[model samples]
Target: MLRQGVSTRPARAGQACRGRPVPFSGSRLRSSTACGAAEVAEAPAAAPAAPQGLGDLPNVVSVLRARGLVQEITAAEELEAAAGAGRLSVYCGFDPTADSLHLGNLLGIVVLAWFQRCGHEPVALLGGATGRVGDPSGRSTERPVLSEEQIEGNVSAIGALLRSVLLRNSPPGAPPVRVLNNLDWFGPMSFLAFLREVGKFARVGTMMAKDSVRTRMESEQGISFTEFTYQLLQGYDFVHLCREHGVRVQIGGSDQWGNITAGTDLIRRLLGGEGKEPPACYGLTFPLLVDSEGRKFGKSVGGAIWLSAERLSPYKFYQYLFQVTDADVIKLLKMLTFLPLSEVDALQAAMGQPGYVPNTAQRRLAEEVTRFVHGEEGLAQAIKATEALKPGAATQLDAATLETVAGDAPSAALPRAAVEGALLADVMATVKLQPSKSAARKLIKGGGVYLNNAKVGEELYKLAPADLIDGRMLLLAAGKKNKMLIRIQD
Candidate 1:
């Protein structure tokens, strides 16, 4: 998620306060120790601002501060009230459209973890039925409807990943999180019963008023009835959570404001019965993360960077974070990391300075995040693969590490008959490289083509079976960066 806003510098450190303590709070405490007869004031106390309740939350505090939603009562008041109420239930729905959750959904996952930290029970809502319908939060077009088996498979896969990630970060002695499939409830629900019970509280007028719906209204490709009913399903999710699980707050990206508020409204109507506090439900939405270029995160020239190792390798995941621009690193560190503000400020300051490089910061962010989502082993493998990117570097990587780096690269074998007298272009093209003979010729001419780890100088360079590094594999490189492996067989 890309957060908005960036001011170059906001005055120098110690410019205002020389003797006075700087107001820094949260995880920014300075520790001191008294050694026998020698007392030391470890580090100067950066007089922390008043400790906010949610500020104690690991990453949610960062999200709230970064999104500027900390001041919103509907957001904070609800969080505070939930904690105060002692195990007030809260939830954020997860639609299992894919095998694994991606970096795009990290914020929501972080929110669930934060909710749990604040001493509230978090219900992980796996959208078994709704995944079939698709939530139109950021989608430009309607997602393809999945078959029951496919949805179920995705739901199971995603549920396992979610449980693994959330459980790893579960605060010590915090409320144990619960994972619930909405399909469990919605599966047996009949259309008539749904309309009478859940659908009755949701109004068409309110649904149409949603920004997601409104955006599609003026377009030639209008919103579908299936998508429009998304709000109703989401609202019903909250209602079910409240009725069944005692969930009262719905947190999501700002785009979910409509659906979240709709759920709150439904809870008020159905459960409140004439507006007597209405279970004190609340809706909190974080700003959708976007970069300075205005492009969304977790997407690139490569496809969506997913969290699942099967869908996206931890190496690739680390690479994705490693590629964060200096412009986005500070914002990313603040949003994605549990690092202290002083440490974050130091990183930001390092990035802003002339000689200080951002690569170290990038690596730190990547390692911390990869370790958080994946295990230490995943981080280690990614580190090895990262080291492998260097010239003349070869590391013994595990199968997962190799697969992560080789992502979609094709593994093809050219027989002896095919390898003899083959044009480098033709050989490379067989593996879907260059796309066309003309493109291949252009790359060869521009010195962007290489074979057997060496540049292809001649246009008609022969790709003989002898060029194979192993019994069949030949290392190919296009330019100094792109690499591919080709094989020859009997």
Candidate 2:
């Protein structure tokens, strides 16, 4: 089943720095080494001032509204006043259906980062308990249940990813982010006690009216009792956080409006008391990340645009942003990057001006976002790999660089004997670069074939030991776009 809102699929641990805390300033990002622990550094001596026009917005809510990050918010004025008055602890939930989060889940992290930048405590709640029941918000069928082992493993991996991304680059004196598992609270609760303390407050008629429940009930597949009660489980999470952790705000995607409100309502009923004042809790939602064509933003032809470098390399991730349409790039820069709105406006204005270079905005968007997700070192590697792998570019190709590029490209492995002195056409066909040997030769004769980004003029050329970069890998290109990496084994 397709998990929506807070739920994410399992992802493996990628090449992310483990255990080390990297400092983040609101105005600028720091660099981190690839795969190794990054050293903690002092905040910059003179950080850039807040972007122009941000001065007019007094609180994080206004900042979010200005950046198109706010879709729906509860008690906007009161929340604004509270945020401006003092730091409020805010939380967003993530269900560990997968090991790594994809592009779809990014806005939540971005929103949390915005809160951090605005001087509020950000809490990331892992749905270790909720993942079992699954969120029914965007589903048409019941979710396949995961074993406890799968759930626990996912929680650990996602928690690591969360810490790596969220804890890094925090503003000075910002509260360190707290990653909590719902299971910590839910695991020990008795079923009868839950029904008495939490379930009693939820009205079944009101619950059935939720879009998630209503939609499922209308479907031929229909909703199950377990899935129907998911909102109550989620709503109680907010109550638990509020009473125990001082968390006062909950945020999520627009699809999660019901779940978010459920939590708010639960807080009001269970904790607000019979007083004239409003409950000290709120819910906010952001528009789902999508393109001009209305297609979801994070998916590619290959698969979900994963946040983990192990699932997808920084180069591939960078390329994805670099290729976004002109229609979408500017908006993305505003929503995804911490770049000043003034700079974003400048980029948007440049898009229609004369003498404008193609993809300048896209390149900047790619670099900024790559750095945010992968760090400075990851961005540098992406750039170097991008430049080195450009078709027919003069940059030298080395085995290390080619291996980085190979992470996102089609590749095959063959014995060193099979590749040495082998006919180029046969090798190309062997790697499935072409439909067959005849097709490979035909492409070669037409001057569309390349070896390590160089044009190949001979249809009968043979692979040589020297052709292998660092004596291990070779890059073959069928024209500019279709490329393959062949690794030789002894």
Candidate 3:
């Protein structure tokens, strides 16, 4: 027989609502609230009543499925009915395996936002404890364990990022998002206590049957006992959240299906007694972000597309989305952004029309996603850098703009004498933009060399003091794609 928590049907049906859904016009949810320690307090003692215009908001499950966000949900009918009935506390856990979250981690946060928009509560859980054990859901080899100190640092950084992003995206008067660390509970409990309380309920046969566990055991680098016990740790997280904070739904990527079911099953075994009713906890998942070739998305030749501006600049993030293929843009627009379905459909339709400009949809996707992740100021910075760096574009290449684009391009320092009154070909050869002066002359003659975004047509063109932007730096482009920055040094 199927497990208590496993569902045979997909949650793709768009359940009807009383009225039209709320379109997430960015202005409605943009707030300047400070996300600090004070806001991370326990969820309010009583669940807040659904906002006054509840009828006007569509069921959150329907909204998610419409946007291609739902993969599989346990007890789909019951979960949908519960969502339509009243406010639900939905959560998604993020393990602090890295210092910053990347594009692959964005869907969970976006799902949380949708729940919040529909007037439900959203909880962001940081897996401070689980990071030490490591999840083996999608891996063939065991993960290298991190030290407690490293885990703690990662937890704090990821917690702050979640708080800021969630708070900024919350609608006005929305309940504040609760940022939690599982270590808070796991730290105090002794291993013996854990074995008695949690381990007793999990059957070895059942655990072995899990896809995550089965696949690893059959591989050459077999799973470790530490990794094998990860599901139990994650399961207990759901139980604690449900009992303490009234959280009822757990959301994650599709790879988490085994772990998520473990939570639901654990809840049923531990909390559902013969004389009592079944616990209302459930699990949901979204498809992993990947490209047409089945390789993971959110990665570039450089590295992961990070959500933190410190790790990857907003300009680079925006550029990555702006370069997405037409085949993927429409799906991403629906899944990633809060743009209305009708609007997304219009963009898709425009792509087939004769007057449609290429990359128009991509630009919109880039702008909306950048605004969500980095906010208005960051979006502006990205757009400015994009404009300033375009070869032969009219936007002035000033020092500030070049500084912003410098993070994504190769750069070097040149002596003032090397640039001032020097032949352009010689400078290009010096910077390795061309293999030799002869090659540089050939490229310049082909009108493929640009100095400060202006095309340099003459093979013998010489650099002037005026050629340097603000007499400090100059942007050099070998073509539309390859660019470098040269800073003048005395």
Candidate 4:
């Protein structure tokens, strides 16, 4: 029940789009895109369609359940009816708590894509307003309020990410995903107006009963009135989207049940009670994606696996997915990828067969997800990176690819003069590769030191100009898996 956001140093400005290159004279390595305002890769011309296996199925719930996407539903029959009813307008909201949406938000956006393929309309809501107060649903402590400018910046970057991932590969005439910011509506209303209109309909007793509030109230840090009233804001968002955009359904992660149900209840009380014919508002939630130990599975040992290649490089992103345990690959494939069920079953079957490789399943999951988020070009770049770091790739690697690899790996800087004609032992000592010159000498003599993926057997060898990839940096390794980038400062 930790709060969703973490403060990270802003990725420096030298990293810009691959198409629009930014000249770098900085210490940290950078990708082709600007880290702060990362660009989305353009999608291919074609789009994937609904499976032929789903022909005339009554609803997509069966699909979701088989895929492990559905955790809770407010109205099972009504949800089925909406899916079967043709061209439903539905949405899932994402708060701009971070500059980019992380792995946790993957299920929500993928659900939206599934609806679009089913020929329904999907809307993506950026919480320009709700993000300000912060979501308390999954937290044990109070969320620190964010500034207007900070939230707004997060809103724009996340909007671009959703659009790139969701709007690609439409079947013949599918509607493009409609993106909205909650602040567009919430910004205009005064505090007194919100209290008189939205807040007036809420019940203090029911609000107090919500698990998020109940848990927080009993904690050392009691709930704030601002957070307690957050339900009203979310409910109003549903009402506004429904009334203004013709959106009829809301979907989200399971932690959102209280807030989601609050919206449906508001719709029923405010709209259906007024003699509205259909009473069409609905809410559905999927279980939060978790691992075998039941911990949420998106954050890596490093941090949240961000969708942006600029934030989390495609190579690291692919490696993260490629490393999922055999126990979790099937469930993750069902949740994160759009592979047909038949293909998923084959991969699952392979996991149980004799001499079958788990890497096959892990590799498939990595390829599908990498292509989806980073595009085919990004996937190719990731594959090239995977090759560059392999056992025998040293001599064949090019400068730009080496730069991309350095951009993804841990890196440090040194004056060029320090590296020129410097002994391997001193270089290792300077980069913290070893505790001291003695330790560096011992490691080099013991066959533990590798320069640019090639083992170094010499303790007193001087680095030649050719040892620097692109004549700019030295790739250092203390062992098979321990590596670092040394960027030579001009």
Candidate 5:
């Protein structure tokens, strides 16, 4: 996920507060313990950031623990014991806030995937029922409720996107991920019946103590009864999964700790009674994925960096991963990829040392993650699209790939004659890359305007018949990142 307004000097990746450079001798990132890095001080006091040099580990929990993925876990010993016993069914729920999951949900997905790789059953629960009544854990205000038709549509689309990525990462013969819509169970029950059976176990005192509830309660926009009962609904979902499918563990983001615990508690109360004991159940959460500035990653001006290629093109998705800050790249690798931690440590070392090639690890992070989510073919498309925009790509890029990569910037359609005989400035203005012809000429003289991926060297440079790339198209770029595809009609 791309943080919208972060500025980090890559040259200072390994600098102490005193500005002295530290040699990467295969150890901690900082040389002097005296200067606690901004990364250390900036992280939340409750959840400490993962330490450097996180090599591969013995078990899933240990790997997550080393990678700093585990922020809060209920009954650590029992969770480990259950997982070690073999074939633990672990799940994480994704509420279809939109038709696609974003970088915000990547941590939970990756955690479930790691368990699946180690032979545990992964149950990806899509919240078809809960989406209609939004979860308020991270929101400052109440969410806009959608129609059942809209939520149901989002559920199926999100389910397909989720399954594509999770199953691609699964071993050939491994148990295919068990996907369930929460509405399957909740749909059949009456409101009164639900209250009598499931809602009865939820105590008011325990509910109010939840930070999400307490904060919303004290706010000017008091939470609605529908939203207040959300946790109860979620709690029963856990109990339902546990009883039917033998799924005893639930994992989610740190903000979901309250709801996750609610589920765990419900599991015990419903099953355990006089002369009977409850089964072992647990909840685990991953820390917030934040940059050094403490702003959540995966958000740009346009919105979230989405998991679905249709929502956010794979080319743009790869670029987002490619732009991750040097400071966060290694940690992101551990969080997002199943790459051996030793390789990540080496990449971490290289990132700290002198003469490190810019974007080497960032590219690897993009490739690994892109391949995992979008598959080999999608990754290839991303790479092809990336290269088609580079310098001297006028005749090199075919028209089809050019159109695909143009998803990055605005595009316009014009007649072939509009580009062939007009001055470069006029064409740039025509495409709205510049406000006026004069402004376009100014940009051209300053060597900021590009036609067909080639920089225009002169203010008066006129577009010629030859400028139509591959005899029929033109790609205009204002700078390195902003590209506009000029579709030329015959």
Candidate 6:
């Protein structure tokens, strides 16, 4: 069996909240309360709760609860109004800086898919233009600038993956998924025109006040002006969407709260400034997926566990889910899988019961998620690989399958003569199992090393040809992060 490793990345940061100006910005658009009491006093009081039809919208709280991620809704009344309006236009963005979305991005994509299913028009925004100016929300350092050609390639690849995933999960006759590149608008956008129109209202101090910006300033790596203006650029995107597509809601990760709100505020200000009836817009942020250990979801030492098959193989993806802890499994099932409530609850309870390991639940979770993204064929491969590795399962697997799995893993080759009558330390050393002789001895004494899928003991089990399941191969595992395929050639 392949030993799996635990992975972690940084936790996603702050989300936008209502009535509070973003945590970092200065008084940009003077609020009535802070700007002028007379003007504020004369303005209309906060509107009363409007009637809501959100229950009629697709997936609602049930999906949110299933994912175990908090849906930080703007307001009940706001959601109701949008639902009643028939086809609430909403947009979510994916930066094309990366060729593929990772598991962390899956939640956002699923949310958009569900929104479309619920009768809201969904817009997939490819941050072609904004991506040129990196978003600083989650970054500790500035991203290296990409060439124009690289950016275009990333956008194309990302779009293909986005279309594939959304089409797989989306129901028939759901709002048609529209793909947009911000570059279309921004490419032709002139600096003078932008300054005269969009930039006038977005004050520098107000922009700097965001937690994303504040965090950047305090960080040793420092922030760039391009990254700082990312929110404003995002705000302008909302205005563009509002005017062009009637999109009124922007949904994103909680770290995107500042940007989402900027878009909403832009809509309000732009329309009001021009003496037009202000178009209504709403913002919603979903909580970032974090494990029980409090680390951000996605990433192992091998690097990001990507959705793209090219980046992360289906077998590896299945193994990632299989390694989930009991505490995180149910939460993941809810967030990542479409398993029904009754079934999920039963599985959760079973996992908690004495002597019940979470393997079955994890496998089911992995299967559902893998199938949803990669389809039946993908799941079949995962199952096949799993069966090939499980104890007592080797005989059922063919030589080709064994070779395929072994070939995919990091490998070592040894002469048949060298393995015979060798100390376990020497065996470990020959295969580069440990970096040094001392470490190899420690591993042998601690019984942390395995030979041919079984734990090695006595530190001196001499290798024999009979121990090779296929008369050629040996599987060695070091802790959970390392797997070495060894072949004894004649």
Q: Write the residue-wise lDDT of candidate 5 on 252-327 in tens digits.
A: 9999999999999998899788878776788999998888788898898888999898888888889999999888
Reference-based TM-score of each model: 0.72, 0.81, 0.84, 0.80, 0.80, 0.72
Every candidate's lDDT: 0.68, 0.81, 0.83, 0.77, 0.77, 0.70
What C-alpha lDDT, on a 0 to 100 scale, does residue 175 get in candidate 5? 46
lDDT: which candidate is best? 3
Q: Write the candidate numbers in order of decreasing TM-score.
A: 3, 2, 4, 5, 6, 1
Off by over 4 Å in 1: 1-63, 66-75, 274-277, 394-401, 407-490
- Tell me the tens digit of each residue's lDDT in model 1 across 1-490: 0000001111221131222222233322121111111111111123332123334444443445653433233656445544543445567888978888888788777767666665555667788778878888767788888877777788888888887887777656565567777765555556676777767777888788888888877678888988989988898888766654456678887778888888888888887775465666777777666777988888878689899988878888998999888888777776676666678888877876899864978888898889888978889888887764444344543434434566544456668677677888887777777788677878998888866446677777776646655545565666655777555668
Off by over 4 Å in 6: 1-62, 273-275, 354-357, 394-404, 407-410, 413-490
Error of 1 at 160 (Å): 1.3
Tens-digit per-residue lDDT, 1-490, candidate 6: 0001001100110111112222223311111122111110011124321123334454443455455554666664666555555556578999877888898988888777667656665778888788788889987899888877788878888877877777666665455566667766665556666777888888778777888899999988788878988898899999877765567778889999888878888888886665566766778888887889988878887788799877777777888888888788888888777676789999988876898864889888899888877778777877787765664343244444556476356788888787655666776777787886577778867877766556676665667766675777777667644767777778
Span of ten consecutive residues with least summed lDDT in model 4: 1-10
Lowest-lDDT window of 10 residues in candidate 1? Answer: 1-10
Report the poorest 10 consecutive residues by lDDT, candidate 2. Answer: 1-10
- Candidate 2 residue-wise lDDT, 376-455, digit = tens: 88898889899877767666888867877876778899999999999999998888899899999999999999898889
User: What are the root-mean-square deviations of the candidates from the true structure over C-alphas?
Assistant: 15.7, 10.3, 10.1, 11.1, 17.0, 14.0
**lDDT, candidate 3, 76-107, per-residue tens:** 99899888776677899999898899999999
Best by TM-score: 3
Reference-based lDDT, residue 357, model 5: 96
The stretch of ten residues in a row with the least summed lDDT in candidate 6 is 1-10
Off by over 4 Å in 3: 1-53, 407-410, 420-426, 432-450, 454-467, 477-483
